[model samples]
Target chain A: MSAALEALQQRLGYRFQQASLLARALTHRSHGADHNERLEFLGDAVLNLTISRLLYDRFSGSDEGDLTRVRAHLVREESLHRVALALRLPEVLKLSEGEARGGGAQRPSILADATEALLGAVYLDGGDAAAHALVKQLFGELIDTTTIDNWRKDAKTELQELLQGKRLPVPSYRIVATHGQAHAQTFDVEAAVPALQLSSMGSGRSRRAAEQEAARQLLDKLRAPPAR
Target chain B: MSAALEALQQRLGYRFQQASLLARALTHRSHGADHNERLEFLGDAVLNLTISRLLYDRFSGSDEGDLTRVRAHLVREESLHRVALALRLPEVLKLSEGEARGGGAQRPSILADATEALLGAVYLDGGDAAAHALVKQLFGELIDTTTIDNWRKDAKTELQELLQGKRLPVPSYRIVATHGQAHAQTFDVEAAVPALQLSSMGSGRSRRAAEQEAARQLLDKLRAPPAR
Candidate 1:
């Protein structure tokens, strides 16, 4: 094995009995037909399950919705890319000449995929314990460091969570209008809770964003005193 | 413990070291603030990982996309609900007086979440081996029985995969029109592959169905000889 690969394994803290698995893990589909796609698939599930387990254990006071959101944030492509960069994945990734020239190694999706493939490789080589340990080592600090308040919750999440805490039925949102040019359209959304007779509207560049804005306003109304 | 609980333990093939864990897993959020939501959150991950590892090892010849599709089919709400029913989940579930009167025990989401909570309880009480064994025992028949041909792939999936196999660009779909009453509108969708200079339109009662039909027609077009 090359010294670089050995160093990569050292960083992972999980040495592979079969070095070929590590090599395959770093290979991109752009490189050849035989590449990391299968490993990436396996690794994606492993990474999600491992992270979900971690979040579930650490946040006893948090509900399932909170746990779900936190897990989604932790395992999303951006976070995986961060972990890949931390492990210097871009240095050893194998790519086709075309992709290499196009900067595929630096791409977020590829880096994140390779990260999952690495986990899958470890699991295949050393079983769950080794893979679990690697996941913990790579992600432990992030898990410990992430405060729920550290990130912005989308307005829909904020609205639903506020209602859930109060054991009230969740508010609903609907797209009320779409306007402007086809290229520069805007979405107008209305969020309402029928039981509370509360409603609000907001508009934005996308349907989802508009819904969030509307939800944010509706949440504020929920917080305010009732009007005569 | 009640005789019914003991019967459940017997069926599970693993007695909980902490009986209270089992009891908590059986409790619904409607029952009280302290409920199975947290355990259900943890168990959902454990179940997904266990099933993923199983599928990964068993299906060596299958591609990642195929593996993903199969896993999704196995883990969807209907599948989980079936598993829960087979385990006699309804007999032992605890709900609030209101929910109980409304037959909440038979609800798919409740049953599925409770099933997951039981997994969490087992994992917590006896650790990974116990959990793995439980999952394997519960799902062994399902793992053995399911074949790729048993479930129908959606038109969009079939089209995308056909293109993927041929190294062609994926098609894009857009809603072209909506007609009829608001209560029962028909959607017209167009699927296009600009790279292939091909396009098709289909109409259906729903947007998704219309898109699928359009994709089906596009696939048919791709299969036909050159029109020029």
Candidate 2:
């Protein structure tokens, strides 16, 4: 194995029994047919499972929605890219000459993919324990520093806060319809921001749940870039 | 443990060490404060990882895209609902009185969530080996019966087949733009079915990849319900 790979494994804190896996993990599709895409696919799943397990244990009181959001925040391309930079991935990634010239090594998507591919390679090389341990080493600090309270607020509270920050009147929510028998009714709620001329509808088993869903939808719209 | 739960464990081929986990897994939110959503979240990750690993091993020569499509077909809500029904989940699911009267036990979404919750419960109760074994027992047959040829076709071919099946003309593809240096250019392609007044665009590192993406987008539009 090359000195660079030896150093990378040391930094990753997991040595590969099969060195080829590490080499393949660093190879971009532009470089050759034997690249990291498959490993990336497998690694993405591994990363998700590991993170879910971590958050499940860490924030025992947090609900599924909060856990999902926090997981998303942690695994996004930008977050992965930051981790990749910390590991100095640009020095190791193998790209075609042209791609290299085009700065593929520094690309956020490529860096993020390589990170996942590395996890996948570790899993393939040393099994679940190795991969899980690697994930913790790479991500444990981030999780440790995360404040659950930031993500614990329900959708309605977040949406209201966002609108209030912009000096807009609070949105209004109303029950638009109810289906099924009273005991098992599904409520459909509509939330409208008159100042923004935006409206969204959501349905759930209870009025509050439906309103929260509607507010979440509206928040998504408000945060999204304007459509072309 | 209740006889019904004991029978479920027998059918699932894995008994829980902590029976309360099983009870909580069977409980829907409508039933009370303690519910299955959190477990469902964890189980969804377990299921995806297990299925991805299975496909990775089974289709040694298959590309990542093909593996992804096949896994999706295997783990979709409809597929989970089928497995849940086979396990006779409806007979054991805990639902609110109103939910039971409204047939919540047999609802596809509820059954599917319960199925995932059960897997999560198993993972917590018996660790990875037990959970892995349970997933294989439940889904191994489905994976074995799946013919890769159905999912092996590229998006363009699948779109062509769908259009031909409907007796419509084949779609046309054109390169709308190419960005970056020649050696590392990204292609943007547009695919259109003039007869249906439908079109979609996709961008990728190569023309073939871009066209496949465009076809996939068009296919998604064709299969989706009419927009509200």
Candidate 3:
């Protein structure tokens, strides 16, 4: 095995019985016919299950909705991308020349996919125990440092609670504009708190999502220190 | 244990070490403080992983996309509802009197959720081996009986292929209408095969999804036998 791969295994804290699985996991589809998409697909599920198990045990009192939200926050591309960067996946991923030129190695989606592929490979090579342990090693720290309250409430709810705590009137949301055809439309919403002269705009695939985005933006503005 | 519970165990082909877990899995939110939603959440992930693994093994030659489509079909609400019926979930699910009167037990979403909760309960009760074995017993026959061809191709591709097979002109898809605001738009698409004087309309969250639905409807119409 190459020194890089040997180092990767050491970092992963799990050795692959079949090194080829690890190699495939690090391969991008742009490289050749044999790639990591399948592994990524399988790995996504493995990661989800492992995370669900972790959250289930950690927040024993949390309801299913809160668990789902927290899990989503943890497994989203951004989180996985951070994990990939920590693991230095860019150094190991094999991408085609064009993809490399395009900075595919540093791309969040590619890195995240590779991370999942690696997890899948670990699962296939070392079974459930190894995969579970690997996931814990990769993500347990993030979950540990963050409080469940960070993700338990939706942005709108959190915004409302924050405003209520500060003796501020609730924000009002209005649909600013609609786009697309009858069946596939997007909502652009404006959230305004006239009392504080704060307003923000957000767009999403659903009215609720858009409202939440707007509320989130407003909350961020409220939380930020006043301009110097 | 109640006779009904005993019968359920016989059907599931696995016995829960903790009866409370099984009871919780069978209990809906409306039933009281204890419910199955948490178990359902965990079970959903377990089911996805199990199904993915199954497809990965069964269709070694299939690509990730094909594997995903097949897994989606197998684990969709409709599929789970069918499995729940086989397990007689409606006869055993614990729901409030109002929910019972409202037919909660037979509702597809409720039944499906219960099925997943049951799997989750099994996982918690007996570990991965028991959970995997239970899933195989519940869904193995469905997977074995169905061919990958049934779901490998998207509806649009399948429709196009069918038309081409008969030397018919390819279908044209046009956006009929769009609804909602800038963020959460839905698209209504009309798919037409002028050669066959057939057309269909379908709607979805995206144009591609709408077009596929339209194509699926057209395909169904074409596949129907000619009237006498």
Candidate 4:
């Protein structure tokens, strides 16, 4: 193994029985034909299950919705990227020259996918036991420190659930505009409920966030007392 | 033990060490506050991971997308409901008086959730070995019968993947209209690729199917030669 890979293995706390699997996990799609996409897919399932299991065991009093919310927060791209960064995955990532120049190694989505790929590799190299153990080890602190109370449903989800609970027609969101640079774009979104004759607008760095913001504003409007 | 519970265990092919878990798994939310929701949550993760592992091992040559598509088909509500029906789950299901009178046991969603809950109960009552074995046994035939070639990418997924591969902005789907009776609603969906200045229209019995049909039509347009 190369010095870099050896170091990465140390950080992962896993010695791959087949080092090739580890190598494949680190190879991004931008790098070549054979890459980490499949591994990332597998890793994603594993990560979800691991986190769900952990949450299930830890939060005995919590309902399924509570468990799902906490698990979602734990496994989102931001959280996965943080985990990847903690393992210094960017140092070991294999990217194409173009992607490398484009800072692919530092990209959150890339890092998150690679992290999942690594977990996939771990599962493949050592089976469920190893994969489960590694996930538990890596996420133990996060699980311990995190509380379900800290997880509020994102605006869109909250709105949808609320409407569903009340047997109200679902709200809709649409992107009204997109502008600025590709890397730093802004999206203007509108949230509407035709049944309620209400609409609210919000803008953010991404379409999802913008939609979420719109939902938040719309929810505010929904909850407000009527003006005199 | 009741004869009904015993027969249900016989059908499941595994007797629970903790009968209470089995009882809880059978209980529906409508039954009472203490229900199978938590178990269903845990079981969902277990089912996802189990199917993922199975697919990974079975389809060594399939791409991540293929694996994902197949897994989605395998673990969907319909498939889970089929599995539950095969086990004669309706005969063993526990529902509140109102739900029972409303035919809750025969409901696809309820049957599916109960199936997952049963798997969760098995995991809790036995452990990983037993859970894995049960899932393997339950899904083995279906896994053997289903072919990757038969699992075509749904229109929406195909469109999304194609756009992603081309580094183009993703398409957005909106429900333009929903008509007909509540029990037999028809949804009119529009799929738009704003960057491409293209849109397609489709209508179906459900919003998702309608959106998918619109996407399919759009893809056909994208893939065809320009009309004279």
Candidate 5:
């Protein structure tokens, strides 16, 4: 365990000033009475603060919605679980005999928790500055490196938020038509603001997809200046 | 505009390789025909990924909820506005005449947007690596610098999300007691989970504040292990 912990420490880029903190971070609730739950709590806050600041500073022009979606994507359960695996966090995680046999280490929720617990350990061992430095080094590379121009666009999230804020009824989407072969299908979607009797049509590979496209078009129309 | 931009550049610790991108980043919609909206979108995604990685690496033991809250607080409207002001962003902002007089330059939304746009500009001016380095340098100092351990306690938001997600009746709060004088009053609150028939109590300085405390207590009860 110590050897694996040492390797994890090397990967984490921070030497724990207090070895006990590191140990606690690795201890899961299933392991015994003592566990990483508290550390998970603290580390969650520390991690969130660091990441929030990074996003805030990096995306100055983005509205709250875009910022939120991107952040959600980055810190989601799946992504965090991937990072945990990349760190080989599961190898050193302490689990009960039952949990270990049940493959708790590979579970997304557990992995995410362990990842957070490690952050708490770093925060406790070295304090906020150390935690911040470590976090920046980890996240900066991925965020700064990736081109995020091509992620899926969700017009529903945008429209729901927009209409809710405006005290307007939420828009609804319906599949108006479908065409072409199954392998090369095309869908015609209609998004309607029922009260306004304004329905816009959009085409895509699936009804849901087409509806989203229609919503985007409708949003543009709604936001456009009124004609003279 | 150049002087102000130069000053901002110096403060953020990056020299834009493509000055045009930087210029576009700073161009607010109100200021001119070309605005920072597009740059804002890209920057938003970049910021989230960067920050997510940072937090993951820094706080190895944190959980999703904890990280989410901390990030939300750090990147919230108010904090970004302060950072924007620190960059003296308002001084060089292009705004429509109406917006200028309405003080849109200093508005929290505008200031936060400009900050993200600046990040996009940095990303474009420099590569992702450069942008990451710049964002990390700028925001690294702000991580977990708050006075209150705000990360541990966002009961109100949590309660709202929980109710919304579970499709349970929204928890309702009522003031159970009040203590102390007007200047230093403390209210005791009871939060009732109607469906669960579970009620918890908490105390705070104001009604809303007390309600949040009660909500926290309620959440704890909900999370408690069931009796065998």
Candidate 6:
């Protein structure tokens, strides 16, 4: 076994009888036939559930919305990817030569997927409790509300309520156009509500992003209270 | 505040400044205007995150998929509803007179929603940490793996893989007939792959269930070991 792999096992407090699962977990699709896609799928669900339960326990009197926001923050792709990197996951990751050369190890999506796949491998090898322990130990500190609450609110929810509080009709969004090919499409969205005509346009790789941008624009506009 | 509410607060190991939120959390939308829809939404997210984190910590070697299954078992609507009832959540629930007479307080959906809403109210009152503590206290015992392992696997997934493993064509499902009104439907379905055909009928509020029933029948057929 490679020294890096051995060190990783030590840090994670686990030793794999079948190291192949670990290898598969760390192998991204870009690495070729033996990839971590299935593991990633399983890990994603596991991560969400584990973190969710922790937050639920820690925040005794919290509302579901707040808990949702905190969970999102704790399990965000960026955060998971960061954890993966901290474990020196990149050093052990078996990627295609081209991908390794292209800095695939540093990619957020790849790192996040690999982390989840690693969790999957753990579960498969040792069972649910093992996976839960691994994830909790890594994320327990992050669950601190002081850090999570700092960035919980989303623009769309706030903007929607801002209008609704004023007895304004709920905003409606329309996809005006799409630019680019299927895998890389940029959407143009227009958000409108009859009571106030605020025309804002947003562009993103997906419709959701475009809508979020449009909402952000509306928020900026609405934040400026009308002049008397 | 009602004495039932006070007893519940003591059991939860927390006091509510705004007892109204707790009352609202226990009130289902089916009951009246002062229901727990918003709180339920918030609580659902919180529950997911907290559980996810805990599983992650407890199971260092486990992956996301196993963790997800475990969490799903822990937080399924039925499970949450049971927990809500165990906490005596229904006693203080404010319901429309008609719903109260109808025993709406004991309904599973209502109980589940109320549990989520209660989590939401707690989060709102005391923030994420507070909500986490409450959920953890209520559900800490659920983390036992032996209990989680006993959960039935989704029959659909099992049947899908069974066909795939044998290198047969992907199984296809067809709804042969439907009987009953729009509110509650009964369906007869057939699930077939090249070498095997299974048919079964089921009644549910939706079509997915009918298909699941058909898949379940197929599972039964495939249960017997094949000649080596």
Q: What is the DockQ of each candidate?
A: 0.22, 0.19, 0.22, 0.21, 0.07, 0.11
Query: Could you give candidate 6's per-residue lDDT for residues A130-188 as a string of tens digits?
Result: 87789877887777634544555665787799998999988888999998888888999
The CAPRI class of candidate 4 is incorrect
Docking class of 3: incorrect
Residue-level lDDT for A19 in candidate 4: 90
lDDT of 1: 0.86
TM-score of each: 0.72, 0.72, 0.71, 0.71, 0.51, 0.45
The number of clashing residue pairs in model 5 is 25
| Per-residue error (Å), model 1, residue B101 | 0.4
Per-prediction tally of clashes = 0, 0, 28, 0, 25, 88
Question: C-alpha displacement of B90 in model 5, angstroms?
Answer: 2.1
| Native contacts kept, each candidate | 0.52, 0.45, 0.52, 0.50, 0.02, 0.10
Alpha-carbon deviation at A227 in model 1, angstroms: 28
Report model 5's interface C-alpha RMSD after superposition on the true interface residues.
8.2
Model 6 spans with C-alpha error above 4 angstroms? A145-148, A152-228, B1-228
lDDT of 5 by residue, A41-105 (tens): 66665666566557666766555456556666766678678778988988988888778888988
Alpha-carbon error at A37 in model 3, in Å? 0.7
- lDDT, candidate 1, A114-228, per-residue tens: 9999999888898777888989999999999987654557778888988888888988888989999999999999999987788999999999889888987987677442231
Candidate 5 C-alpha lDDT tens digits along B1-228: 377778877988887767777777777776664678766665654565456546555655565556656667666668778878888888877767767888888888988888877876776567556767866775677763532245765787788788788889888888988999999999999999889889999999999889988998898777653322
Give the interface-residue alpha carbon RMSD of model 1: 8.6
Model 4 misses residue B169 by how many Å? Answer: 14
RMSD of each: 13.5, 14.7, 16.0, 15.3, 9.4, 13.4
Q: What lDDT is reached at residue B86 by model 4?
A: 91
lDDT of 2 by residue, B1-228 (tens): 889988999999887889999999999878876889899989999999999998899998777878988989998999899999999999999888878888999999999999999999998899888888998999999999987868766899999999999999999999999999989999999999999999999999999999999998999789653332
Model 2 misplaced stretches (Cα beyond 4 Å): A152-154, A157-228, B153-228
